[model samples]
Target: MSLANIFDTAASAMSANTVRLNTTASNLANAESAASSIDETYRARHPVFAAVRQQVEALSFDTLDAGQTETQGVQVLGIVESDAPLQQRYEPDHPLANEEGYVFYPNVNAVEEMTNMISSSKAYQMNVEVMNSAKTMMQRLLTLGQ
Candidate 1:
């Protein structure tokens, strides 16, 4: 791995964390939403991530290597809805209540979502710090020859 690659890795991590934060916000937004039917109920969502790997380009004779792969960054595979059971409540007087007098709520847990948001934000901040540190190191390297 090269120093420049650190920036790429940190950037990818920040992007993934942004997606995570978005999903957490979405889950929290729909946490209280109620639906009359299972199909209409909103479900908590989460983003899946995978590490991106690439073959390092051989820039010189010394760089040539066999079967060498480096992790470039992170990739967001996709967003998935949680399969946990939805909240079922007996609210007969509720306008959206079903015939059985039960209103279905999203499976989103507010506390969990909040915690996820905090975690994502911290990850993003850490990535930012990483990028800054890389930048500083690069700058110092450039000044060394001056």
Candidate 2:
């Protein structure tokens, strides 16, 4: 793949990771929220990603008629809420308790969210490194003429 394509792929991956980090932050922020009803409770959200591909023209003169497909980058399809059951607690004294003295909490798992945050951060860093490496390679190539 060309260096320009490398930059594009890394940028797309970084964008997707940003979305992941945002969703994780949202889930963590609502982890402790309480609601009187199930419908009012927050649900853990996660972003969906898919590979993006594009057709490229054949570079070789021998197979100019043939087309090639390459992965451009990752794309965020959408955010989805977890289907796992919410936490129901019997907190009769709680202000948001329902008629049954139950308060509903989000399905968000703090440990899981924290882990996801760390993973997303690492992925972003890796992309940055990839871009930097590409830049250095391009610079070195330019210096070869001197």
Q: Compute each candidate's TM-score over C-alphas.
A: 0.90, 0.90
Clash totals for all candidate models: 0, 0
Candidate 1 per-residue C-alpha lDDT over 1-146 given as tens digits, one digit per residue, 9 for 90 to 100: 87878988999999999999989988888899999999999999999999898877544446555444365899999999899999999999999999999999999988889999999999999999999999999999999988
- Give the clashing pairs for model 2: none
Query: Which digits, one per residue and each the tens of the lDDT, describe model 2 over residues 1-146?
Result: 77868998999999999999999999999999999999999999999999998866556557657757464999999999999999999999999999999999999999999999999999999999999999999999999999
Instruction: List candidate 1 segments past 4 Å from native.
Output: 56-71
CA lDDT for candidate 2: 0.94
